[model samples]
Target: MKVAIIHDWLVSYGGAEKVLEEQLALFPQADIYTLLHKLGSQSPLIESKQIRTSGLQRLPIGDHRKLIALMPYAAEQFDLTSYDLVLSNTFAIVHGVISTPDQLHMAYVNRTMRYAWDTYHQDLAAFGVGGGIKRLAASLGYHYLRLWDLAAFQRPDLVLANSPFSAQRLQKYYHREAQILFAPVDTEQFAPAETRDDYYVTVGRLVPLKGIDLMVKAFTTSGRRLIVIGDGPQLDELRAMAGPNIEFTGKLSSPQVAEILSRARGYLAMAEEDFGIANVEALASGTPVIAWGQGGVRHTVQHGKNGWLFAKRSSESLNAAVEQFERLDWLSPQLIAQSAQQFSGAAYRASLRQQINSALQRREQEN
Candidate 1:
């Protein structure tokens, strides 16, 4: 079968990119299509593939990260009829691709568009598109994108949601049902450490939405030490504002992150994540997590078992949770490592292949 994979962009490697890699492994002959492709700036897995891009590639903005802003307009360009099977790993625009009856379009969604509406207005406002005008533009953009996002749901023969929270959102926002498949976690690469070091660890982009600020505040106020991994727009200002107990370790190699996760006393996740890959990584490292009870963290972290979930998404709630962590016995390394196996790469691949096969069989029967 001629399989075609679609993704929003190839600017940076993250959880979505990891899902794309797994799809490629399942269908080695697949062709990849995207709205934008940054030649040397993707995961090694993506860089190794032959990728095709949309007309947006012609724009100067395509060479830089700013092209993400053009995605609402960029999505209208895809035509998927040429492929026999279409698998879209979409966090944004690739879902807008049009498909034929003969072609099966399966979408693996990370989350609904975060920047276009209710989620990240403050981040969008920073672009200098002020007040009423920004709100008006964003409103119109959300209307158009919502139509586009819902339309993709119709094209897809099946949808795979990365988390239960995402599955619920797909039903709520798009009014579409989806199968739940947690994103893969490479347990082999992130093995449990023999002994943990004293500091706490947190990983992910340094963005306002990520709520790293909450973790920094909670850890600092409670006199706990923390090492933060990853970087973003909020990095500099956050570093300046953070107390001495918190250390910001910009972006690091995967091995470096694994090493840090291995030795940490516990992982601190403050974001309202769609599904947290780092949370699993911490569990694989035999480190329990103290995470805010929101979004996918509810699905991934089992409170007081594998990790503790903060009842609220605030510094006080997180601080109180950390205090509670101090009271409980650190979970056995063997049990923590065992919990990580639930999200292993092998399990993800098997479940995805099974779903794809089922979708294909149903499509054939319909024909």
Candidate 2:
């Protein structure tokens, strides 16, 4: 089959891109289509693919990262009927691909669009597009994007959601039920260490939604040493505001991150994540997680067993959970590592192949 892998964008390496990489492995002959392609910065797996980008690629912008903000407008440019099978890894607008009776379209969604309508005002203000004509333009943009996003859901033959939280969102937003397949974890690369170092660690893009500020505040009040790895727009401001006990390591190589995770006393995750791969990485490295008991973290973490989950996202709640983590002596490193095995790469690959085969069989039956 001639598979066409559709992605929102290829500007940065993140969870959705990781999923796309895995999909490429499954369909080695597949061609990739995206709104923009920022080559060289991504995993070598993507760089090797036969990638096709939207008309946005013709723009004179030196940095492809800037094109993400323009994706709402770019969705109208994709033509999806040429391929036999269409597999979309959508976090944003690639699901807008139009399909025909002859082709099968499947979408792997990370989450529903968080900024299209519900957070439209916040996003507009963040971009300095406020009041008068800017407000009018933002309103038009939001309405157009929302309709496009909603209409896009109908084109897919099947939808696979990355988490239960995402599945719930799919039902609520689009009235579509989706198959839940948790994102893959590289368990082999994150093996448990015999001994752990004394610091707590947090790794992710340092953004507002990531709740890195909350983790920093909780770690400060708990009097525990903390190390933060990763960088984003908030990094400089956060680093300047952090206390003496907190250290910002910025971005590091995957091996460097694994070494840090393996030696850490515990992992601190504050986000209400859709599905946190880093949380599993921590468990695979034999480090327990102290996280907010919200969103997909509820599914990934077992409180006081593999990790401790705070009931609230507040610093006080997280600090209280830190104390609880200190008191708990029952979590064996072996058990923590074993808990992570369920989300291993091998398991993910097997499950995904089974799903693909089933999808193909169903299509054949329809014919």
Q: Candidate 1 on 156-250: residue-level lDDT in tens? A: 77888999999888888778899999999888888777777789999988877778888877777887899999988898888877889889889
Q: Give per-candidate clash totals.
A: 0, 0
Candidate 1: the clashing residue pairs are: none
Q: The CA-based lDDT of model 1 is what?
A: 0.82
Q: List TM-scores for all candidates, in order.
A: 0.93, 0.93
Clashes of 2: 0
* Tens-digit per-residue lDDT, 1-367, candidate 2: 7888888888778878877877877888898888888878688879987789988988999776456557756765667667888888888888767778878788888777777855666767767786898789677867876887888887788898888998998888888889988888878888778888899999999888888988887777777899999998899888777889999998898899999999998999988778888999999988999898888888888987989987787888888888878887957787888999988777877888888789889878978
What stretches of model 2 exceed 4 Å from their correct place?
A: 62-73, 117-133
TM-score of structure candidate 1: 0.93
**Which pairs, if any, clash in model 2?**
none
Candidate 1, residue 205: Cα displacement in angstroms equals 0.5
